[model samples]
Target: MTPPLLTLEGVELGVGGRRFCENLHWSVSPGECWGVLGPNGAGKSTLLHALAGLRPVEAGTIRLQGTPIETLSRRAVARSVGILFQDQEYPFPATVLETVRAGRYPHRPFWSGESAEDQRLALTALWETGLEGFDARRVESLSGGERRRMEAATLLVQSPRVWLLDEPTNHLDLGHQIALLELLLRKSRGQQGAMILVVHDINLAARFCDRFLFLFGSGESCQGTGEEMLQEALLTRLFRHPMRAAHFGEARCWMPL
Candidate 1:
């Protein structure tokens, strides 16, 4: 069997002399979409950061496509991976087009202007993200959903092989939430690349991801197919709720626990 595109082996992440989670082993294969489910303060964000090579690993190793993560330069890593956090702050004043254009930075030489190809890719990304109509709008004036899409557009322009997203549906309405989830599923499962998302909605994860990683507070993790793992009893235990799963046309929907 072919090995996974990304792997975390006995990983340990710490901050300010304290460890949040330790000894994590996870892998992501091509054409796979993995959803990370955990309660608040469960170090979900920390885990994402560690996987993206943004945080210092106290022990163990991270490899991207069999290459040690540390061996890649920051720019090279950025070119290969795109990450969207739950809360991203933009202090600079720039048009939405300009902001998305920033995504092309990793692909261009420093101090160089965007080429014709970069411009074409940027515009295509905007169209893919549903921001074509608002390309020239100020970033500070976009609605919550629009801003989220704008950030997604930026990442799309990166042409990354690996995607990391945190709480991607938080600001989206029901319709857009479904749309985004569908897009993610299509891309990850078809031809784009591997994707790992930190999602709090169990139902959404069940419907979209090929695999699920349940992160527990006890420093252990469980991963398997949605069908094999998203049982009512297991979910009840995982979330400390009376939740139940409902089957809906090749997907499992969540109801109150």
Candidate 2:
């Protein structure tokens, strides 16, 4: 069997002196898309940052391709892992194209300027993200949803083996949400990629993810195949609200009662 692309062993996480995740053991393999479902303030974003090596875990280890992530250099980590953060700050001036091109920064040699091929790849990402014409726009002028798509375009151009997305569809309208998820799903399948994204939409998560991780925010968590974890009981307990399992046009869906 192939080794996992990313693995968390006995990981513990917390915020504000409260431990929300305890002994979390999960592995993400190539070509897999895992959804993280949890209520607000459950350390979902915190966990994504930890996986990207941005912050230290309270306990245990996170390994990237069988190597302890802590031991890797920042550039090394950036080359192999990519994160689509929940919030982004653009403090300086740059066009959307320039911002997306920054994804190539990790792959190119020091001081090597962006090449034609890099420009092509960036344009392809922009097209894929529905920002083909918006590339010329200033990053500061785009709306929140447009900014989200811009960030996604950057992540696509980066093309890392692992994707850590926090509420990737945040601020997106219904159509854009579906389009972005499908695009990411295809990318995840075609690029030897593994994805772990935090999502609040149970139906959307059920539709797109093959694996599931539920964080209960009480120092407890669970993981399983979607089939195993999408039970009504699990969904109800996950949100502290009753949920109903229904079939909608050949899809198994869970909705709150």
Candidate 3:
């Protein structure tokens, strides 16, 4: 049998002595999109960090393609896994094109300059993220939505096999949110890659993700696919409030009741 793209075994996570998840076992394979859902303080971002090897797990292990993540060098891991954090800051002045081109660093030899193909790939990524004409603009001058899209473009240029995104839709307008999700879906589907994203919007999660992971706070969690995971009771309990699950056409949505 083929190994999963990513796996967590007997995972435990916490911050400042507050536990988020315990004894967690999860796996993600190619062509799958997963949404990590939880209320505030549920450790969603912490979990993403753990998956990306940016944070240490309190216990247990994370494996990428069957090899323990800790055993792999950082550069080796970067070649296959990419992460997008919730907030990003660029301290130096740079054009959007220069920022996106940085994704090619991992693929190049040490101290090598960007190649024509790298530039082409970066431009393609920018076009895909709806930032084609903004490449020459200063990154600091872009609005929140534009900055988010530029980040997306950088990740696209990286082209990792497993994508870990924390609140990818942050700062995006409704249209841009949908457009970015669609772009990610196309990329994942085309390359048979996997995506695990932390998301707060239930409707958007339902629309894009094939599976859902819900953190109920304090070392409790549940995961499932389809309408089974979208149950009213499950959602209500997960959010600690009344929630109504409804459908419009083919989409499933949740609302506070």
Q: How large an RMSD does model 3 have?
A: 1.2
Summarize candidate 2's per-residue lDDT along 1-257 as a digit string, tens digits. Answer: 78999999999999889887999999999989999998898889999999999999999999999999999999899998999999999999899999999999899988889999999999999999988898899999999999999999999988899998899999999999989989987897798889887989988888888999989988899999998999998888989999998887886777788
Candidate 1 C-alpha lDDT tens digits along 1-257: 66787998988776666555678788898888888887676778888887778986889899988888988888988887888888987798889888888899999998899998888888987888788878789999998999998888788787677888899887899888888767765655555578898888777777678788887655666778877778788777777788876777975578974
State which candidate, 1 or 2, has the greater lDDT. Answer: 2
Order the candidates by lDDT, highest first — what do you get?
2, 3, 1
C-alpha displacement of 173 in model 1, angstroms? 1.0
Poorest stretch of ten by lDDT in candidate 3: 245-254
Candidate 2, residue 176: how far the Cα is off, in Å: 1.1
State how far residue 25 of model 1 sits from its true place (Å).
1.7
Q: Each candidate: what lDDT?
A: 0.81, 0.91, 0.89
Q: Which ten residues in a row have the lowest lDDT in candidate 1?
A: 183-192
11 in model 2: Cα distance from truth in Å?
1.0
Q: What is the C-alpha RMSD of each candidate to the true structure, in Å?
A: 1.9, 1.2, 1.2
Estimate the overall C-alpha local distance difference test score of candidate 3. Answer: 0.89
TM of each candidate vs. truth:
0.92, 0.97, 0.97
